[model samples]
Target: MFNVYITKAGKYLPNEAVSNDEMEGILGMINDTASKARRIVLRNNGITSRYYAIKDGIITHNNAQLTHLAIEQLYDSRFTKNDVELLSCGTSSPDNLFPSHAAMVHGLMDNRSLELNSSSGVCCAGMNALKYGFLSVKSGNTSNAVCTGSERSSTWMLADKFNNEVINLKNLEEQPIIAFKKDFLRWMLSDGAGALLLENEPAGDISLKIEWMESFSYAHELEACMYAGGDKMDDGNIKPWQDYQAEEWLKQSVFAVKQDVKLLEKYVLKLGAKSTKIALDKHGVSDSDIDYLLPHVSSNFFATRLYDALLEEGIDLPNDKWFMNLSTVGNVGSASIYLMVEEIMASRKLKKGQKLLLIVPESGRFTYSIAYLTVC
Candidate 1:
């Protein structure tokens, strides 16, 4: 089997920062009951702070701009545009109905040799794209690839529609807003972009080499979370409210994680990599055996639940092995796993010869992906 390595990685966030308190104030300006609005913000999502694109200190940037900036940060003039073999953008937000975000990124790069593709698998686009890209590289179809996942949820958020749903200020004061409007708005929304460059050989500072990649889909639960039929103004808006129900998604997510672990166990056993007992042993030496762990950043709640599930499986891993920065960056959909890998490498924690395990759970259903990496 051929080895696929991550040559470089980059992340970009809008200049303006929005804390929970500021968000509450903004919500209050549009809603009558400011206190109730604040509570709504606190209870629904565990997000404390998230980055936003800004125009003159105001939070706003379209998908095109975010994609361009993220790529620029990743490329950093190290390679010319023509050097790129594949340019893929995994995003829920595209600037237009046609041309696709991948085409837009290609134009931004101004390179003629780049082949472009776009994916819209919600938050899982990042991991799914990587799996596809690795296959392309292993098949000798491409030697270099760039994968980017970007979103500008703030632009799509309809604040006016949200405030109008508040029927009675007194009613809100007495009870929680049962309106689907506010809850949906808070749930399936976040903004940021992450880009990664993959090559057959190590480039600059090598992060980790890709040893294996796999993906599973649970199409039966597709309707568990979905968005359909909206104009350009409301483009990419998800619906049915149940999509943002974290508790419901958690059950399916855990099932996916266990399934992926079983698959990984099979892969490792086939390759004679490690015995089942060694892999699941409670000893802290598992860290010495496998250098790092990068799990999907679905949410803080999801991360905690996944960690607990791993413990139940007899996989003892310290908090230090987990690369979780969602509290600082929020969830960048598919970009979350790759971004976590970048964070771990940049922190100078990963040493040579150590193995890293990458895990991602797709939202809305019980599907997951697992990949193993070794530091080169």
Candidate 2:
């Protein structure tokens, strides 16, 4: 089999860590609904703090810039930008529709010679990008590739539609109770970027070696589970594309993630358990053989439930083997898996030959991907 390995990893966490208590202030003091909503989200989501990459009330970095900085953090003077043969980028939040985020990163690097690729929509965008780079190397299409999952979630999370500001508590009881599903993530979603460098074979050193990867999509049935687009007018039509105004749209066009709690309760855990089995069986890996579990669930609500579901599926993983950063990082969208993987590598606790199972489920386009990695 062709060899593909991740040689290095890096990340760019935002400058500010907004705690739950602090977020209550941003939600305004209009009524108790905001306070009650905050408690429900944090309690259910398990996010004590999350970050925002904002500078003077503006987005400090785009998907390309965030990923670019992350890749730079893994910089090796010996292996310059010229050594990179290809770039594969994935993101749900891109600066512009055309040019692709990968191409934009190339432009930001001021190095346009390398071939570039990108995948968009959903949190799984980043993992999908990794798959492209992995296959490229495995198929002998390219040797040195940079796979990145980057998101400037703060841009959309704080968009005008959901971020309502109230001055004083004059009419505290007048405001309606918030539809938690519609606005839950305006505060829950954090911002950051993460990256990994891959090669056909081990270079100077290796972080993780690829064993097998499997991804499937249920987008046909799960469309609009999480999405971003222009708002429709009351006249039962969308504003003409040419008439679309950026300033107005930026304020009202929120990236919404509204899911029926029952639907998630019914299928979320099953997807995680089933995907784990599918990937492991395809590669002939026994459930008892796993040394670690890196789950990319959006919240602790799902993480806890998925843990039990895997047990029912006969994969009894110990608690210590489970790795998650949702409490501190929140849901960083497409960059969640990359950020998790980068942090694990930085810990340097893994010994050679340890098998790590990375479970990825993206609701954007509803792609479920599982990656098997071994320490080298």
TM-score of each: 0.75, 0.86
Top-scoring candidate (TM-score): 2
Model 1 lDDT per residue over 1-376, tens place: 4568787777777766667766534323334434443455345446677765544435567787777777776655667667789887887666787888888777777667666778776666776667667777767789978888787765444344344334343345644242333344443356778877778887775557877665555544232232322211233223332444454332222111111223222232222122222333423334456667776654554555555556655565678777777777766666667668768878877778888877666543444666778787
Model 1 quality (TM-score): 0.75
C-alpha local distance difference test of each model: 0.60, 0.74
Task: Please give the distance, in angstroms, between residue 322's alpha carbon in candidate 2 and its true position after superposition.
Answer: 1.1
C-alpha lDDT of candidate 1 relative to the true structure:
0.60
| Candidate 2: 10-residue stretch with minimal lDDT | 162-171
lDDT of 2: 0.74
Q: Mind giving the per-residue lDDT tens digits that candidate 2 earns over 183-267?
A: 6666567778898999877755446888878987765665334545643356434344446665544333333444444445666
Candidate 1 stretches greater than 4 Å from native: 26-30, 35-46, 54-59, 76-78, 163-188, 221-223, 226-288
